[model samples]
Target: MQESSEVAGSIVSEDCLDEVIQEQIKTLKNAQTAALSAVTKRRNEIFRLMDNCDNLHLVKSEVIILCKLRDKYDESFQQYEKHLTDSSERNTVNKRHSENTASIDRFITEMNNWVKESELQLTADLDRKSLCSSSTTRTKSSRTSVRSARLKEKARLAELMAQHAMREKTKVMEEQELRLKQEREEQEFRLRKKKEQLELETKIAMSQARERVYAEADNISDIVPKDTPSPLNPNVDPFQPQPSDITVDTPQLKANVPCSSSHCRFPEPNLDMQLQSQQEMFLKTQQHMTAAMLLPSIEVPKFKGDPIEFATFMMAFDARIAPNASGDADKLYYLDQQLEGEAKDLIGGCLYMSSSEGYTSARSLLSQEYGDPYKVSMAYIKKLISWSALKHEDPHGLYTFALFLIKCRHAMTNLSHMEVLNHLPNLQAVVKKLPTYLQNKWCSLAGHLREEKGGVDFADLVEFVYRKAKAANDPTFSKFALQNNYSKP
Candidate 1:
């Protein structure tokens, strides 16, 4: 989508404005018409999806797609409304707008209907199934029946767990996509605002230049008004206009004078003003850059004394400010400003030390307490170990687990103890936290890995879980999986 936007932007110019806008309208209309047809054709399949949905997740996905299509229809309709400038254009736009409005309204009505029906059906099915299962458990308690029931219950739990995990992944991916979309929109908005600001500023600059030129025109004429005295003799009556002076006006104040003194050899006001405006804007931009050095964020982020976080903070501080500092005093001042809580208190004693010694001592103390590789690696590992065993249907917990595992792996690599994590106790402890399906995949993969290498490694486990976590999040994966289970209407 961003690439498409960029392509559209690059192709648009003053000369091609009408062409680009028309293309935008045509493309949007085509997409909306296609979406309307799909929704119309798949009405029954959509109903079936809701009927078989475990909850209302599938219904929500369909509604989001519909809402997006409706919004595009609206945007295109609005653009056409804006495009209409004549009576004939107005009639055409009005007709198209009415048609699109009807489509969008219908789309919204269908979405509302889908939500209402799916919610009621899901509630009824859940209650019915729960009551039926409980009744079956009590009535059919024979040994074979109990065994089958247990198997069925286990499978159902696994299915729910898988669903939960997928939902979490989907949520994370969607949020990421949303953020990207917002950033793009913000960038485009800023670009537009900047262009407008420049144009407005240029117009004002030129207007000022014209005013200055016209003011200077007053002093250009040597011929005085009939009642005004000449500069050489204020008491004398004003000089009468000569034939040449009556016909022409000029300023002889500077070297660049006309041969006939009929006109001042003024530079083109428009060209001069443009160059002045560009120079001024460039200078202001340079001054802002110099003053900010780092902007959007001007200061280094503060840090407390968490060993796991200390390494990142130290690297950032060093990279951003340390190299540019004049001496230890500046460095200490910057460091002192950034530290807080335990980190700040830990370096408090070092402030009494003189000059380089104080800065040196404070830095050393910070390093010993919070930048130790062993301590940092242990902290990362402890976090991994401390994670609660993921509940059977907790997708958010699983996502957090994957994120932390990746962080832990990064810390281990930095600590030069990557192999330490693959030890039997550590490896199995983390594995036991995964859901049943993931455990099964791990077992199968571990067995093959052992056969190939004489022992299994933890990287393989991380990679496997990472892949599953990603797959679970992907909406496309969910869509295809859903489609596989049901034919389209």
Candidate 2:
């Protein structure tokens, strides 16, 4: 029985030991699960830290690349700015240079024009002098011819006188011869008549005596008498001359006769008539010669140089031909017809110069010289203005035209005003191209146009201002009015 109890005790102890071991095992298992959780959390934290470090490296590399690009952009921007600045400066310089060149060219051109004008003027003067000299020479030659003609007429008169005297002397001699012949014929006729009368008387006496003797004898023998042939029979009186046989001698006239000096007197009345007829002829010839001398001879002088000088010379010559009178307008008109082509154009330009001088001056000059001064001056102004506008490069032409417009402003009409307006843009361009002083001067005039008022037109105002200034003896105002009045609208 004792042994059985001990065995049971050992078995109980063994059960107890088995139970403690199970409890300890449960505790260790719980500790092991908690430590595994802590290790896993640490590993996850390490992995998260490594990922954050890789992200930072990537971000830093990206920032470095962006910084380099920004630096490159800044450099490029600076270069672009520098290039733009340089280009701008260069452009400005080129513009300046071009303007300088243009101004210099303009000045040179103006100088050349002046020189050419001077040369032309000199040449014209020479031509005018030459024409005057030629005219003088022609007059001298005409006088010489007239003197020769007079001498010839005198010689002819002397020869006619000698012929008349000789003819008169011959007529006297013939008359004397005829008178002497008539006297000799009368004396011969008287002598012949006396001889015939004596013959007839003798015959009558003989017949009577014979008849008485026969009467006594016949008483005894009448028959004897009848047989005898009577004395009156046909064959009787044969000694008497028949009428057919009778001859009368005529007296002969002598052609030659001696003349007394007194009978050969000069024929004074006939001489006077001949002299009078000759004087009439001489007077008629003298009148014709005088008319020829009085007539004007047109000789247009040649001028190769200045048109202005030529115009002046031509005007003077024309004046000499016909004085400035309304009646002489046709002469001026015909004179223009005689000019052709370039000569006419040159004359027109010279007329424009007169227009530029002043309206009053142009009026006086043209009125005296041309048939229709107003019409001619207007035409000239139009032509010049057109030429200047068409050939825009010539500043001299423009300047001259502008001057003409200013001078003749008072003469402008609606048509002229329109013409001025049409060319305004071109005129402004030309004005800008002028020198600084000119520009200021023109601008001042333009200001006047803006300030001007009243109902008076631009043309009338110009005339009034000009006259007023002149009357006031204000040279500056007069000059300004002359230069600027036409530029006003």
Candidate 3:
């Protein structure tokens, strides 16, 4: 019986020891699981903090969050240490447990201080950086505003300067234009004044010229008279009485000579027959040369006792021979007895006698006849012409003889036997002595003779005149005769 009871006690004691060991192992395993979970939670918390603050976003707040996390981890570690120091947990065979606790405690302490210091430094840096950024932004904005104000002021000043310059330039141009217009007006005024002055002077000069012309005309009118005759002919007296000595004497030798032939012979001439024939001939030939008109004879009244009166009475007797002669020879002899000796001699001296009346005379004895009375007047004219050549006479005498012959030709141009033979040579000689201008006068006389006598032998007389003119000493007479040969007689 005793052995059975002891065996049963040993079995029960063994069962109790096995149950306590199982409980202790369960507690240690739970503690280890809690510690591992806390470490994993803390590592996840650190990783989240690091990720949220990568570019320093909210740096101070992030650092503060990290400190709090470190504090939480430290408290959890202390609780783990308390669990480990319990008597039953102390005698347990947990290996390297104190070293693990101490390592966790040191890590928690370093993390807490690092987190506090990081929070403080981060806060100071953030405050200083914010202040520097605000100061830089304010400086930039001030510079931009100042630049805008300066640009506005400069634009206003430039606008004012440009306006002032334009006004000054416009004013100067207007002044210059005004000055130019004034100068132009003054120049025009001067030109107008000068034109008016010149016109006035021209008018004055024209008036003076007209006045001077009138004055000169008046002076010329006063200097020369318009109607005065040339002053030269007061001394000539055509009616003066000729003296008794003016008688032409006849040569007795030629008066008595007998004729050599019938052509040279002439019948004796009585005053009455001679005057009748001459009057008939002169009436027939009066159309030829009429240079002078012979005046009619009248009876002289008896004036007694003055010698000058007697001489005048003789002139009257001589002048009347051609008119008073009659066809009766006895009546002419009685009429010759009535005159004084000087008067009868003067009657005989005449070469060509004039008939005072316009017709032939009648028989007379102290009875008057009317015209040229004798045919022998032509014969006497011929004798007178021949005598002029014999005497070296003056041209005036020959001119007087030519005038007498011209009258004789007018008295006898109708008579068939009537001849003017002696007048030609003397007329030619007188024409030669004359100047060319006087020769033209003789040419007129010769032309008169040709018309009256109808057959006057003037070619010989013209040739004679031409020869004398050529041989003469006068140049004017020679040249005129050479140039006008047909005009000479």
Best-fitting candidate, measured by lDDT?
1
Preferred candidate (lDDT higher): 1 or 2: 1
Give one digit per residue, the lDDT tens place, for model 1 in 317-388.
898889989999899888998999989998888777786999999989999998887788777777788888
Arrange candidates, best TM-score first. Answer: 1, 3, 2
> Lowest summed lDDT over 10 consecutive residues: which window, candidate 3?
357-366
Mind sharing the TM-score for model 1?
A: 0.39
Q: Please tell me which predicted candidate would have the highest TM-score against the true structure.
A: 1
What ordering of candidates by lDDT runs from best to worst?
A: 1, 3, 2
lDDT of 3 by residue, 1-489 (tens): 799989998889988977776666566556665655666566456545544323344444544554565455455544544545366765552444556556556755665565666667778888999998889877888888888898998999899899999989989999999999998687667656755655565556555655665666667556444444445577975567768866888655463565343344334335455445545554444422121122222556432322324434445655765355664353345444555544344344221233322121322211221122333443444454455341232444444544444544544464333344435664465455456654775577667877888644634344444444344424456444465665777
Candidate 2 weakest ten by summed lDDT: 259-268
Estimate the lDDT of model 1.
0.73
Error of 3 at 331 (Å): 99
Better of 1 and 3 by lDDT: 1
Q: Given candidate 1, what's the lDDT at residue 2? A: 100
- Score residue 20 of candidate 3 by CA lDDT: 73
Q: RMSDs, each prediction?
A: 44.9, 47.3, 65.3
Instruction: Report the candidate with higher TM-score, 2 versus 3.
Output: 3
